[model samples]
Target: MHIMEGFLPSPWWQVWFLVSLPFIIIGLYQINKLVQEKREALPLLAVAGAFVFVLSSLKLPSFNGSCSHPTGTGLGAVLFGPCIAAVLGLIVLVFQAVFLAHGGITTLGANVFSMGIAGPAVAYLIYKVGTRAGANTYATVFVAAALADLATYVVTSVQLALAFPGTAGFLGAFSAFAAIFAVTQVPLAIIEGAVIMLVFKYIVQLKPEILTRLNLLSESTIKKLQEAAA
Candidate 1:
């Protein structure tokens, strides 16, 4: 999913970077505000970021010899909120670019917007909506994570198509990539959803207090447990 340097023409790539700069700055500022408000969550965010970085480097075989890995943005967003996750994602991309050359510098802005911003934002929204509709914690996390992964790929496909508009314009190229990518991504989404559920289940069991502090455990459930303990 990471776009390579020189994959697209220089002029268009430069335009993308310039256009995405403001949004990146805004996202970073939001992350700073979140850190100020919830200093305790900073360590957790770092841990999540590291986890994502490592996971992202691991490439699983996919169709046509292409490979993919878990973005882990959904998990981060659900835990620390979308803004923080977006910032963390930028950090992850920077590291990957310098060390692994997974994504290029020229296309960093586009990559961040697609994989970092869009994934976490979509996941957080879905989680919030699902929770508000009375979905269970596991269900909310799983569905949100899955949808977030799907959204990331969708955005990436669109970016690729736009970057390489030829005889086929944006929509035509997008449709071609989307059709191929979606097949692999759909199953990837399900795997991510299950992984999130499993990780969350263990986290709740091992350190229930953290869940309360994070506001992830439902208030109603917490109250019932407190009453039972008393």
Candidate 2:
């Protein structure tokens, strides 16, 4: 859901930067705290970042000559919370913009706000609520990941709608943009969710203790999940 470089004009770009700045600041702090307090989680953090970078870089063709791809932020959001996932997403976005030219530096703020902040926030919230409600762990993860992917595009559509409402106005523009994104995004989101769920399931089976240590999943919950999976 990269908005491309120079696509957003004038005040709109600046507005997005202003909107995304606080999350960046908070994300920085969260990353620092995570590093200091949970040194052992470094490898997993790297994996999460790599997941985002690789998946988001795929760039499949979409409507209106735009492109779509999996955000891949759900795993990190689930593991470390949305703030830390934002930091990972920022890093991925920067790298893609610089090297791949996949997205633009000018639109970095908007892109981050959508894919990093908004998407991960939704995933983190869904995960928390789902787990607390005693939903199946894998199903909760799947829904979180899928919805996070969709949420990124939803925010992107909003950003686009606000920037260029044209004659149709905000609501009309929003509907148009959202429809274009949904054409490809829905199936991609489902695939992303399934992939994330499988990865998380692997982690759950291999290192349930790590999840418990992070307080993301309890020992008893893990046990129940394993039993159910079996």
Candidate 3:
């Protein structure tokens, strides 16, 4: 969910902006490097951006200015990596803010941090662990996508609590925000996971070499996929 426009106080928003900027720069560099290396990956990158934009833009109603939606960063993280995911997520957020009126400029950094950096990072880690654990391809992708989406809301709740620690204090406010978001976000995340898994399955069937070229598909994963197909 976006923290909404003008919701964050001064300094807090500025702090987030400063913090997220470097990640975006790094993300840009990573993307450029990927492009130079694999020109064919351009279509996949575009699809990842579109996924983030479509999924994240579907806002659920909020009590306060904030609203919840799927971060959609995990798909990009799996297809590319966390750095590229962050860049894609940032672009989606900016587009949403300008045209959709969902998120605002004041809260862009906080939104990007939760949706772009934090969530995608978690997704990348989960993917690594899942593969190491020998989880099936679908299950691994699903877990990564779902957990990443949840992580985004968790970080968003924390950011909100930090910005406005009410009488109940930071932890209390954070819990409250998290609980509220869980109602809508959990289901959305599951859906997101399923969608990503299906998309990945289609990609695998169409062009398994793409993942191999990106260094994403390990030999073990390839063997598992072949076994599953067989």
TM-score of each: 0.85, 0.91, 0.86
RMSD of each: 3.5, 2.7, 3.7
lDDT of 2 by residue, 1-230 (tens): 78899999998999998998998899888777877987866777888798778877776445445456677887788888888888888889999899888779889999999988999999999999998998888899999999999999999999999999999999999999999888868987887888789988988888898898888887888898788788
Tens digits of lDDT, candidate 3, 1-230: 77889999997999999989998999889878878987866777888798778866766444444455666778788777888888888888889899889789999999899988999999899998988887777889999988898899899999999988899999999999999888867877787788778878877767788788778887567767766867
Q: Which structure is stronger by lDDT: 1 or 2?
A: 2
Segments in model 1 whose C-alpha atoms lie over 4 Å from true places: 34-41, 59-66, 222-230
Structure candidate 3, residue pairs in collision: 1-67, 1-68
Q: Residue 209 error for model 1, in Å?
A: 2.3
Best-fitting candidate, scored by lDDT? 2
lDDT against true structure, model 3: 0.83
Report the poorest 10 consecutive residues by lDDT, candidate 3. Answer: 60-69
Task: List the global CA lDDT of all models.
Answer: 0.79, 0.87, 0.83
Clashing pairs in 1: none
Q: In candidate 2, which residue ranges exceed 4 Å CA deviation? A: 40-44, 58-68
